[model samples]
Each structure stands twice: as C-alpha cells, then as structure tokens.
Target: MNRILRVKEISELLGLSKSTIWRMRRDGLFPAPLKIGPRAVGWRESDVTDWIKSRDRLQ
Candidate 1:
C-alpha cells in the first residue's frame, strides 16, 4: 500500500525546513498535501519519491 508522509518526515527526507516546504507547495514546486484531518495534512510517499527522481534527472 502507498504510504502518506507528514511534514516532518518530508522535511527530514529532503533536508529542507518545514517553512521551505510550505513555500514550495505554495509556489507549485512541490506536491500539495492531502487533508488527513481538520488540522493535519500529508503527502503521498510515491509523489515525493517521484519528485526526487525528477530532481535527480534535472541535475
């Protein structure tokens, strides 16, 4: 099954600050999170992995 990752996990995985992730999301540079709860959000692990792979191709 596909996993969902919280902001902390994504931040640590990408070595980016949570604010930076939020900015990226705002700018459409990152995938938008799914609303997991009234005050919680998460990203699909596959989406993040695919994003990383795409970044690798660009570099």
Candidate 2:
C-alpha cells in the first residue's frame, strides 16, 4: 500500500513552509505532487523521502 502524505505533513517533515513547497511546484522545480481527488493532493511518502535524500546528496 502506498503511504501518502499531504502538503502540511510534507512541510512539517521537510521543515519548510507550505507556501515554499507550493511555490516550488508552481515553478516546476519540485517533484510533482499527486492529486488523489479533485479537491485533494498529496505526495507519496517514498517520493518525499527520496527527494530529501536527493537533496542531502547534493550537499
């Protein structure tokens, strides 16, 4: 089963603000978030973790 997380969760996990993540989405510089419904969006936990690890590797 896919463990999904919402924007708020991702923001908290990443220690960043929702607006920052949203802005990155708008700029197409962030991993694409999945839309679970017309009114709901989220990221897979694995995807979020991968992104974090990727960022870590860059440092």
Candidate 3:
C-alpha cells in the first residue's frame, strides 16, 4: 500500500517550507495532494518519490 505523507514530513524530506509546497501545488508544479480527511490533505509516497527522482534527473 502507498503511504500518505503530511505537509511537515514532506517539508523535511524535500528541504522546502510547507508554504512552498502549497504554492507549488497551487501552480501545478507539484503533485496534487490527496484529501485524507475532511480538513486534512497529504501526498502519496510514490508520487513524492517520483517527483524527487524527476528533479534529480534535471540536475
């Protein structure tokens, strides 16, 4: 099963602020988060990992 990552965890993993992540999502530059709860959102682990790999390729 795929794990869901919260904003704090994603921030730590990507070395980016939570606000930046939100902004990226807003601009469609990052994967859209999944609605885990009525008021909570998270990204899938595989999605994040793939995004990291794509970035690595660009560097």
Kindly provide the TM-score of model 3 when superposed on the true structure, using C-alpha atoms. Answer: 0.95
Order candidates by lDDT, high to low: 1, 3, 2
Among the numbered candidates, top lDDT falls to: 1
Residue pair clashes in candidate 2? none
Better of 1 and 3 by lDDT: 1
* Backbone clashes in model 1, listed as residue pairs: none
Residue lDDT tens for model 2, 7-59? 99888887889999999989976789888999999999888888888888999
TM-score of each: 0.96, 0.89, 0.95
Candidate 1 regions with alpha-carbon error over 4 angstroms: none
Candidate 1's residue-wise lDDT over 2-42, tens digit each? 99999999999999999999999999999989999999999
- The C-alpha stretches of model 3 lying farther than 4 A from their native spots are none
After superposing all C-alphas onto the true structure, candidate 2 shows an RMSD in angstroms of: 1.0
lDDT of each: 0.97, 0.88, 0.96
The C-alpha stretches of model 2 lying farther than 4 A from their native spots are: none
Best by TM-score: 1
lDDT of candidate 1 vs native?
Answer: 0.97
CA displacement after TM-score superposition, residue 23 of candidate 3 (Å): 0.5
